[model samples]
Target: MAIGDWSSRMRGAEPCRPGTEKNKGVAVSPSPARRPSFREVFAVPEFRTLWVSYVLSAVGDRLALVALTLLVYDRSRSPFLAAVTFASGLVPYLVGGMFLSGLADRLPRRSVMVGCDLLRLLLVGAMLIPAVPLAAMIGLLYAVTLLQPPFDAARSASVREALEGERYPLAMAIMGSTTRVVLVAGSAAGGLVVALFSARPALAADAATFAVSALLIRFGVPARKAAASGEDQPSPLGQLTEGIRLVFGDPALRTLVGLGWLAAFYEVPEGIAAPYAGRLGGGAVAVGLLIAASQLGAAISTPLFTKKIGPLTRLTWMGPMAILACAILAVTVLRPNLVASMGIFALSNSFAMYQLAANTAFVERIPNEKRGQAFGLATAGLIVGQGIAFALAGAAAEVVPPSTVVALSGGIGAVIAGGLAIRWRGMSPAVGRHTARHLGREASLTGQTPIHAARSN
Candidate 1:
């Protein structure tokens, strides 16, 4: 399928009709028919291939990171260097997302993803060599990590192209929930693998996963031309500038991105889980539980939220849910016990499932040509924001109790979320108007009523 073909069929590509009811001026989608089932989503061969490949790569990546971090600590016995080794996986995202993600738009997405996987496979295999020094290993790891953003951008854009309408969000929910579960399981599995077979085996396993993932993409996914092509295609710098403008220039897109970034606030608990658990007279096990609790709520609730809720209703609840996701974190102020603290974290994350709505809306609004760069920009900002938030929370924890720091973060997030919520409400009418006009034009071209055009598309 052509990229432009999928772009034209994007959900909400058509606008509301003149007589449709609006919720406080926000354009709501018409009542959709029966929601798509997980079985139906999985029935798409491309989706199944992409999903399995994703799972393989994600698990391998986590296991490799854990094994590598442990190897560094065991060799050097320097806690700080070990920590830095672990963090190397994350710090490159800013650079890759900002500078390299446009490759997805410039090249066929399938090519970008497969190339990344093959490159990573080579890098991980290099790490398996006995003569590779610790410093050289770290450098190779950095090189491997740098390839992730383009791969991610390509994969995400491909998924959007593969699934349409409600299937897209449902696919996202599946991936989102799977990611949380994989994080927990992969870490545990990594530790076990290292304990038995050692780090070399773990690294070898990671290299094999990348090889398999590359093969899957090469064989299973249909090839499409780059989204941005032709003589008028923008330069890389031009694409970057356009992406920044496209994401921030629109009121709805900006607000949706803001809502998604609320993670920088609600996620403060994870940053301080160790100290918080210590305060509760708990140990490493407590820290693990605290961290897992944060992910558990989302894993359990997101699928249900997407499955049962209509798209319009999901949009309607997005702001309130974001507010609650943040506000609930303030419960830490009461200094709850370990189990209670876990509950608070879990409940907060359950509400954070609102992000599924924000994500769906953001993708629906972006043109396919700009989607990779736009997603990259959003992802980079999110990573930078969370990194800063974590650093600040850690700093504040030195002066005050972790609970107090968490409460302060939550309070600040709630205030910000409230302002953004109000802004979203004010901007709804404009979105509804714009959507209506677009649908009207499409209807004229199709010789159909606006409502009929909306449904048929």
Candidate 2:
């Protein structure tokens, strides 16, 4: 949709009228606009540079993951170790996010990002050395992932700073779409490399990407606030707590985080089902197809997320919408086999668009200063939620079929998520005490519609 559409809908957006206690969740109006035309994402020199760096790094992430999995399998001939290689990397995601990501806002965005890239480069390079011990390879993987969340937070906060107002949702859409594309591209490229010359070439390629990504960050991003002034600051751990506190303090944010947590729970089967598929004799290529199918569906349905009315609204259909999405994903696990699992994943992804819209709505609802922590907390919630789901699914794989557990989890997630969405969809815009994100762009100060306002969120 056009900026004008979102502006009109958001401006005139009303709170839910109180009837039962049910309407308490979504009865607030969105505060005055954050900005007018956020569509000019690439217009920012720094963001464009980061975007390029991000795309390259995205490819590298996939390559590293694939190469590591293959390398571990080749060395040990143990499925459990290979699975550990894939799953254990995520442990740092939870820990780093919980204890470290708060440094994103507290530190210079540039230094945090550049430092992360270099750290990952060195770790990945370590993995590329053939003479390295098996434990050394695993250690390097853990280190690389441990550094992920802060870098992720820095990039997220910088995007909000770069694209104020109507452009924020568009930026999210672009980023989401880019992520899907990267997953597809990276996974495919990783598989091809593994098939051709084994995993070392892929690891080296990933390391190369990290090295260049670090260099580009130095060239493109501005220095940290403390570094620029030579001032000491609070620890990253302290900053992380502040971010968490900011997120929980706001009503709107709480709703967003809640739903995000549910979404994370709902998503684990998508990953776990791959190994399940492999166990059913679907093989590596089958596992790849399963991922590709779902993502393809997600890619096609991504545009629906730019909805102007937003999911966090009185007019929003987001609650049942989210429920339906989860129901679809869960039911995918009730299938007869892996092929059915893949098909269900593809179908479920289409239904999952509602969740994406809900996420964008949450972003739009949050104030400027808190956006860093809010988004960071939201990201953390997602990681935490997914971890729970993954762990549960993995455990379930030992007792019952993974597909069955996936379906059960999906069903439970849908019921809970649907109920939560229904309750929160009644919440008003709740924009009390909003913060200014930046200097206003001259383009839409009067709230005038753009000349080229062709509808395309």
Candidate 3:
């Protein structure tokens, strides 16, 4: 199958083949017990390498986050500073995105991806050397973030092409789920690594992970050509605008991007929720547990939701819904205890599931050529939205009580998100059909004790 038009446009100067807004619903049943297990799917040589490289990188990312958090906390002795440092990591992602992101489509995906790994390796490696100034440290990380767009696009587009056909959706689903799960596991493991050793050691481990990921991609992934944007097209600025136009041109694309913003919108409560929890006197451990519990819900539930809710489904509604549930759950603790707060926090993870659904729909609907930039754009949107959310939530803490703020934000989210999904469903019938198919498969398979057959006739 040809890569979609929007995808084509993203690949540099070339004009891409156009795409239709065809509603391809997930078939009600996945291939049965005869179908390959998720593990088995990766056994394919290309997939094996991609999996090894990525999962390792994921672990490393988690460790680095841990290290960054600990380093800042130890230095400033201020929790807010640590949060600021973490939030800073997101800034380059937005800033560099508009300019450098086009490289994803312009270059060979394999090369771009490996370069990103190597660059990250260097950035993470530098952290292990204590002499690096904070100025330099932040600079290195910013540079590293800037380089990720092409690599991200390459990896994303590669996944779709690598398993082109029926397996594509499943592939997207698996990758999305794996990232979520690893983040959960990684966060815990990172904390442990930091506690056992120190931030320096954790960062070293992150560098090693990036190195290994580079090696895997260098040696293992089979090369494939992607659709090229015209060679004589506009300047870098022009390319970025082109990418923007291509993405928003379609209704489906517009909705998918909207979903990304929605994820950011409702996510703010959780981003600052723990700090709010801390203010309410939930100690460090309690704050950590609260955040972890929420993410855990997302890690556990999203894949199952993907299987159940197909293309037509939108999770924009759920981000707020989950936030509202979490808020309601949070408020119940007028003077909340750790366990109850943690449980409420856990419920917040449901936004993660919604994000997964949104991403899957996007991967399915958007044209492939533009996928990288589209993803970059999506990432940028999330950063922007999350920034807004973080500020709003923080301000809410100042003016309103923390719990009240969280609950109110969630309540607003629920109404807005639920309404968005309903309106989206009405506007795009394909989304509905796809969602139903995704759900049908999940429900039929969930109770069957797995290994049971689920093939189409």
Candidate 4:
């Protein structure tokens, strides 16, 4: 089949043919198309609204988590209870991603997102009630967190619907970079806010952010029909089963997801950051610096990778970059000091910019109707994998040096990445060919070289 036909089928849209445009059953001259700049992407009203809403919700969620964790510690004075409270936000994701993420495809995506925000608003607001017991507060927080997978799945699918071509990957880059910044800043701000006014006010602020997010999504985002709606749509369980098969059964997709899951290995440093810091004779400040350095490297590199590299090249380099991301961590075996360790972590994470390629390729391959469920399954696996990795790393650290654990993790990850890289290289030519064909068609319509074509040249 022609690449155009394949692309159209994947996106659930009609193929655009050369020398003509279809609009409301009328054929007209094709307009020129080019790669969108970040400014151009932001200029899209829907994208801008979604971006702002995502930022608000992310910051609010982080703030609430920190405040709740601190509150639990203050009252119970048990690090175990506090850790459980903190973990409450993550543990429910498996359930939600497996069962509820189908809602994004079954109902109107806008409705799903807005409804999730409103529900979270109510949940967070309840957390502020003085009569709510500490145990109940944690339950409410779990409920709030449970809504995240569906909301995130909907939002991700919606962003892809809103942006096409290079714009989608660019938007991903923007969001990824912003998330790092929000994580670092939100944690610090949450601590300060809790110190000054206590947890209730932070909870209230979280509720307010959710309210604002709902309003923005409702009023600012353009409504679109759900990708998988109608009486014939499968039940949630059916959808989940299909999603798993779709993601795991396909060799290419399986490899792509494996590449994405490389995080479980390289992120071990974060799981043992405190112990690693102590091993270096450093303090909490060092721990903070180590964590921040990891985020900083991704924040700085992701945008540059997306903006400077073309789509095909990004795909071509994804494997090597992922390998380097993990391989560099082997340097930890040398037991470097705090500054050197931070640099090692930063450089390792910088190579992780390859995730942009893996993510974009995965999105492009999946059918639009199944995108949400597929994304949810992928995310669920990632969260569960990271959870297990952290547990194992922590256990290993108890027996050996944290740096040794990190190096071991890196060495294992590098070996796995090497295998995945070999698999990906075997498959990449087909992807490159499809990309070239797609860009060639776009160039024919646009009367100029498409970005990927120019970059590949």
**Top candidate when judged by lDDT against the true structure:** 1
What stretches of model 4 exceed 4 Å from their correct place?
Answer: 1-34, 430-457
Compose the digit string of candidate 3's lDDT tens values, residues 76-163.
Answer: 6887867766766477777766766666667677877888898888887877786776656666666766776566667777766666
TM-score of 3: 0.79
Worst 10 residues of 1 by lDDT: 1-10
Best-to-worst ranking by lDDT = 1, 4, 2, 3
TM-score of each: 0.90, 0.78, 0.79, 0.89
Model 4 lowest lDDT segment of ten: 1-10
The prediction achieving the highest TM-score against the true structure is 1
By TM-score, the better pick of 2 and 3 is 3
**CA lDDT of every candidate:** 0.81, 0.63, 0.61, 0.80
Once superposed on the true structure, which residue ranges of model 2 sit more than 4 Å away at CA? 1-39, 222-235, 275-282, 307-315, 330-343, 364-374, 429-457
Global local distance difference test of model 3: 0.61
Give the per-residue lDDT of model 1 (tens digit) for 1-457.
0001113233343432222232112323444356689999999999998999999999999899999999999999998888788787467977888778889988999999999999999999999988789999988998998898888889888998999878887888888888888888898789999999899998999999999999999999999998888888888889888888877876677788899888999999988888888888899789989989999999899999988886656776788898999999998899899889999999999988888888877776666877788778888788778878988998999999999999999999999999888887664432233556754664576564553112211
